[model samples]
Target chain A: MANEVESTPNSYPMNGGIGCHSYVKNSHIQRALLHAAKDVITEAIVEKVDITNPWFNSSRTLRVADFGCSVGPNTFVVVQNIIEALELLYRSKRHNPEIPEFHVFFNDHVHNDFNTLFRSLPFSHRYFAAGVPGSFHDRLFPKSTLHIIHSSYALHWLSQVPTQLADRNSPAWNKGRIHGLGASSKEVREAFSAQFSKDLQAFLNARALELVGGGLMLLLVSGLPNEFHSSQTNSAIVLDLLGSCLIDMAKMGIISEDNVDSFNLSIYRTCPGELEAFIEKNGHFKIEKMEELINPVRWDPPDFQMLASHLRATFEGALEEHFGNEIMDELFERFTNKIGENSHIIYDQQYIKETEIFVSLKHRVTDYEV
Target chain B: MANEVESTPNSYPMNGGIGCHSYVKNSHIQRALLHAAKDVITEAIVEKVDITNPWFNSSRTLRVADFGCSVGPNTFVVVQNIIEALELLYRSKRHNPEIPEFHVFFNDHVHNDFNTLFRSLPFSHRYFAAGVPGSFHDRLFPKSTLHIIHSSYALHWLSQVPTQLADRNSPAWNKGRIHGLGASSKEVREAFSAQFSKDLQAFLNARALELVGGGLMLLLVSGLPNEFHSSQTNSAIVLDLLGSCLIDMAKMGIISEDNVDSFNLSIYRTCPGELEAFIEKNGHFKIEKMEELINPVRWDPPDFQMLASHLRATFEGALEEHFGNEIMDELFERFTNKIGENSHIIYDQQYIKETEIFVSLKHRVTDYEV
Candidate 1:
């Protein structure tokens, strides 16, 4: 698998679908909210999901999956939270022990290691459990089987970057590529919007087919509203800082300008109201409850040491692939020095919140005919 | 003159001190702080004072004063915030030029209003200025010659109500004082702390003789340091809402307990750190800068409207008092029914920052040589 993945010299195309740790790192906030969500879901959807009468053969068996299960503290938190809620739900049904039990599944991409997920699981899973691997975009689960689906900090990536993005001759696609710049130029803004809408619908379509009747789907994703505009000065500051670092690396002949130009990373953003409406439009599911968390999505303060370490990590992954490890220390020190002077607030203003977290629940009102 | 002043009927004392409307009613936050102090002094001070300042060398010129000046706002804000360093102090000096010109005395009572003071006046006075009003226990200036020594929100009938407070051992003093409960009782907490010190220093001795330096002591006054000791549960809240109306006539037997106590008034609280320290040390000064103003100090969501209104004029003076009257309806509704239920932040939690504005400069630095 490693050879196959590495054989593709310009594997950047396949990387479009490869979920980055940035998204995974973004899921940490969901952990803090899981406890509060227990009551909210109970009052809003749990009691409404009536599984009374065993003979009626309702969709009594629950399969809860954390779909883009990230590594580290967040994944553990979500898994534990789901189990806690399910246990409470089970205890509530003590009068009728005949109630069907819950089955848990944790799924992620092919690149995600199952060993880590396996080690993190609790020993006591009274209800059944499984670890599914493969992209949700592809066929990863059985048809119409999932009862409750939750994917926090995922689903923003397109199945693949539009081919026309690199094709300069195709005016429409080239325009779409340019529009993804810092959220200024309305045309570029609209370009990202159109692509996001198309990709989001595809995501919804895939989940719609997998969810059983009366299943709940909870999703948390990142986005910036159209109203948000990065001030020219702030953007300039970040660009200058990053530009200097890239220039120094270029002088060292580590990474070529051509590689930087050809690189196309997906930056996804969606409005809360628009996303909610998008889910509602998908006929297979009914919107049971939707709420936008007021706090920022990726807002967390990084300490000075963490800042230095983050620079080192970035270099290790992409930079070290091109440049030998010898220049690693110099490159990291230069980056940190620039950050310390120009972007001191990236560390000092760490306490200021700037991320948004949203939770949405979807229940299967109808089975997929196809 | 002293006996005549003492004999002048108690009509002024019970007449709510000053008319709610006569003072400037449209003051902004800065102005409201000074104005409210004017009222706090009128109602709380026991004697009529010459409110002016006397120059040290040329005894004819007026001396100005401010207690708890804490380096005057401008420079200190920079030291604390680091962002907009010295900008606050620079702006304050530019606006209130009077701070540096007169024989201006800066006082902090002990805990020091240094943040506000330092940020207010940065450089040395172009004309002449000094720091004098120390602790209200010892005299800061001489007798009967003050031209104008301004202290806003400084005097509030002492910390705990005077020691002789409930000693109705003399019926005249005890009458209807909280059902025989002395202000210094365990239930009242620091209520008598100020009065105990004041009586030992001969009841307002500090500022009594310091006026030999000035004439017009413009004072800003009001009940302040809204501390609560379980017994005073929601006293500020009750006064702001229900008590203002009923308590007025309740004392006259116009309303019964069923009608009066049933209504709760909202109370606003301030820290005792400023006034408590000043009273304990007993620094004396001429009462010059005296005027009541309201600067509504509150929290996010503005849970207490009535309290905000009552405190609004404390700093910004009559200007804000008028402004508050206009929005009284919506403000009261929001405070009573909507505050806790909906957390729509109406004001920053640090709203009404300078609760009561007191400005009194010292004519003498310490007790006279006699």
Candidate 2:
């Protein structure tokens, strides 16, 4: 394959196809998050989107995009909700002209299973669908083309693991950890935060260039509260346990400790304050709405198997790439066992306190001089 | 899998991925045709396209689409040629302003392997890339969005097989054959032609809706001369032999005869006269250039194995859907053997006289009365 500008250095496509381990089959929690955010999304569009703009009447089409859309059942649901909400807005305005036709773009990294996504598109969807294969942190569409951009649970994925985390001499060197949380040093944690800030800026800047003036962006990201430590989140706890399982395999001579030391997941949990500050600094978009969504799922006693499957579906590709494909079953088995041993910590109210941030932003027309 | 209006009734996606049997490896002939038409395409754009239109200055972007773009190395080549030619035109015109950015859409059936296509995109190409997943015989884009549309060796694929060919009692009932060529009755051939005409009209009408006024369309199709019979071409000879191979299997009791009777390849080869008539009847596009391309490949003894592989790459999916997967190996083996037996006919000058038609058309601004 030719070197492609669209190919991100660390593209982590969720497991593709409809297999038991695929994202489509294992994204129940994400689906729950989408369902939980539906009303907020609808309300945001109704409140902030300027459907009466002359642009809408003249274009005769509404262009919407879902960024970081993996091979989906959830992304489909997200786009449909957006379209329905837009339709509601059009109806409420009582403008006699026919509702504009919908043209939706499903965007993700080049390696994302667009084939499966395309195949799984809802046949009766009123929208014309196109799959955009590129990193959202880069410009993926022509300027002023997109009207609504939606991304859910995807902003956490940084472009790449921060370079300093793997350097042996750097203060941020994360020698024995797979992420910048749960026993990671303050320097390592700050490195992750800095990377997140940079990634978010790139995302916002690129989107600002692509979106039409007054266009709306609905972002759903998993994050911690301002006062909460990164280590308190359920994801950090599970991932820490996963890292321990990798260590156990190393001790058992099943895999190398060096491989474990070099591998760090490229994900970050941003706080609302940090996100707001970054967006303010960027200044291309106005923060229309930002709220933490309520927890949509409660797993009493925790379904360890289901959790394992979900984690596998989301990270199997990345894990396999780093650790080799042979150790997946044993490694996940050990991770599940470790999760069982530490079930109390996972179920504790303090540990399960991660929040999903729902943000609505409007493209700042004044900021775009052209 | 909800009922999608975008889904064509009889979509035939070429064999995807980069495996031995994939279209990527076997599309040398298509590549040759693309190369053969490059000069003509460049000349047509330079001669016929009005780059000075106010729309180009205001939009600052050009949108081009390649329909029926199978998972490709060839499609990439085609898009590159177009971009380069457009750049040449821009430089020659000395417009002073920076050339408008190119946004290219690679369109094929929803079943096409867009993942592979996206991954194979040129890294340094100066264009934004997108994959539109749906049948070309339907509306795939918003009205007046596309500036240039290209389809090569794809318009021959009908939306579906003619219904009468399988009616058993109809005059067009094509038993013991898989196509309306070579010993098939005139009624069968006429049925195939009618289906092609209908499908072509649908393609034209949809494209007419999507293409901006004064948009250019470059089309390359395999065709026979107006005076020639469908059975006189190289493709027809090979297909007729393939049909005989199926009948041979039926006689050997390896596969049921009824399956063969029910199956007809949903493909038609149009002549220049027929294509011109259809375009004129449609009345949306003005024909700019229509000429037969010079043959780029000459197989001295005819590379039967290569021909077999190429045919397999193109038809394996449709064949598997019609005949059970179990018979694929035996079916192709028999096909190869039959090709060997009829090598003389395939190599004969008269039979190998199939011409590739390259068409350049401009969307008629006056005709599209908005």
Candidate 3:
């Protein structure tokens, strides 16, 4: 993939299904993220929703989608939490009327292992579940039909690695890097920023077509914390280590150096300003709240093994695709040893492990007309 | 020159949306019918259903249908009751830890007022709803897919009125009379009976292909009492009064006398023996319980004006089609006056009111192997 960046799956899903090391394992992180958006989510269910609104209430069915619902035990867990939260809000109403019935759609890329997602579903008489495999960047449902949409830890992923990054003549070309990281060229940063802006606009445009008036959308995505810029957080360190490992491998002649030079991770670290600017430009939704959530660190960092395994689950597929599958075990082993030897790493800085940007947008009434 | 037969609503729906005299207003009759089948439906819930079976239980989504869901306030009511009953069964056992999510399909003819159904739907956070409009006599759903099916006051309707009733050469041709009634020719009776048998078989066969093993079906239909055959019940009085009204009009040169000869209601009254023989012949479901419900007389019949209005609302379309719309008011006025003049008619013989056949069937296990 030195030039052609069309190959996707290697960089597609974080992991498959509900496994010990799969996406479910990191649910505590998502649960915390959901908790951060509880106020807005509750507000969306109670204050923002009109109980007697004919478009949604008259149908007696509530349609919801978790747009980037990767295979999960977490998917079910997060939705369950949301339902409970919404139920609590409904119970507190003065009139205390009947609640709308729920139809939940769990959506991800077409290649996402939906069978595993279905197999692990928790039984309930409260709501119905279906797996809708599609990209959130495109329209995946009937127009003006959804009442609520939830997406957590997903939007930061761009549609693909920026092709502009590979153009030698382009000012935004990214060279000698796998992602926009420490001391990355302005060109690298611009390429990633441009891709994110385009993708976010497309996402907003599609969702605008799908949500009913007074509908709400809650999103939890990775972002730069306050006072941070490109490559400043601990997330950047992971990229630093990843790129270093590949470079180290290239020097050893185990893989071609040109492959490492042309590859760039298709992801972006969004700040509040960037999020606001994108929302303003799209104009489909009215932003209710957009804030950063950087938790107070409580526990000590996990050992090298735990850290290594987490990264492995996420980046192993991408690495194996670019390099041969045989280099995976050895590559991670080197990564682990390198992290273990860096004594200054743990004490010098906060890695920004849990900083996620949370945004809640109410579907604008004018857009609902369509 | 023929026996009396009252007209069917100009053809019948009580009212479009859920309202007084709507399907919901007839709740008392349905309630009694549901209670009669409670034992078998319970047996279906506990013994017949395999809880841990993956085909249904493992996926965590349960699919159900109400085959002739005309329109709602009652559609929601019945499905709600079923969910409640199913939940009650789930709560009775220590191992009843899991209850699958429910996806309910509301089905009817393509011409059914689904818009009104959706508009009047009640709110609930319980289960999801979707409208599937199609004839139940055909395959309305995917084969071996549904778990439980409920149809009330629908199957007694033949696919269409027996063609033989209009075929002049057929022995069963119902000329000069609209339906099988006392003193009606044996040919008319046989024709209607054969049509009913054929339609019910088609209905059962379609359901057999859709239900999972151990799935249950509950049906409530208008039928004759133990002492009554086709023409002996009070239901015949409706046809009798209708035919009389039509013939009277023809004598007056109000409606073309020949028009009445070609019109027949596409409904049949099913007795226990008939329903039983059909199930036996179809050989897909086991008759867990089949009973005749005969209530003690309690209330006086409605006045002719009220009766005429109710009939008008239901059969007005069919009536308007066969007879000119201009004659509707005059027709019902004549009908009301005729009943007023027949004060001694009630004492002539007992009319079959408040008698319906209730049957519950369990899908046989061998057929579940699809």
Question: Candidate 3 residues A255-289, lDDT tens each?
Answer: 88888887777778888887888899999889887
User: Would you estimate the TM-scores of all the predictions?
Assistant: 0.41, 0.96, 0.51
Kept native contacts, fraction for each prediction: 0.00, 0.71, 0.00
Candidate 2 per-residue lDDT over residues A331-366, each given as its tens digit: 899988888899998888877778899999998886
lDDT of candidate 1 over B20-97, digit per residue (tens): 421122113334343333344433321232222123222323344453333333212212221121223233434542
Winning candidate number (DockQ) = 2
lDDT tens digits, residue span B20-120, model 2: 88999999988878888889988987877777665454557799999999999999898898988888888888758478888899998888888888878
Clashes of 1: 156
lDDT of 1 at A6: 21
Global Cα lDDT for candidate 2: 0.85
- Residue-level lDDT of model 3, residues B89-158, one tens digit each, is 5566537467666667777654455545654556332655555544677665555567778887677766
Better of 1 and 3 by DockQ: 3
Instruction: For each candidate, give the TM-score of chain B.
Output: 0.37, 0.95, 0.85
Judge candidate 2 at residue B34 and give its lDDT.
84
Order the candidates by DockQ, highest first — what do you get?
2, 3, 1
Error of 2 at A110 (Å): 0.8
DockQ of each: 0.00, 0.58, 0.01
The window of 10 residues in a row where model 2 chain A has the poorest summed lDDT is: A1-10
Descending-TM-score candidate ranking: 2, 3, 1
- lDDT tens digits, residues A264-331, model 1? 44444565666766666665566666565544322245343344453343223344444445766676
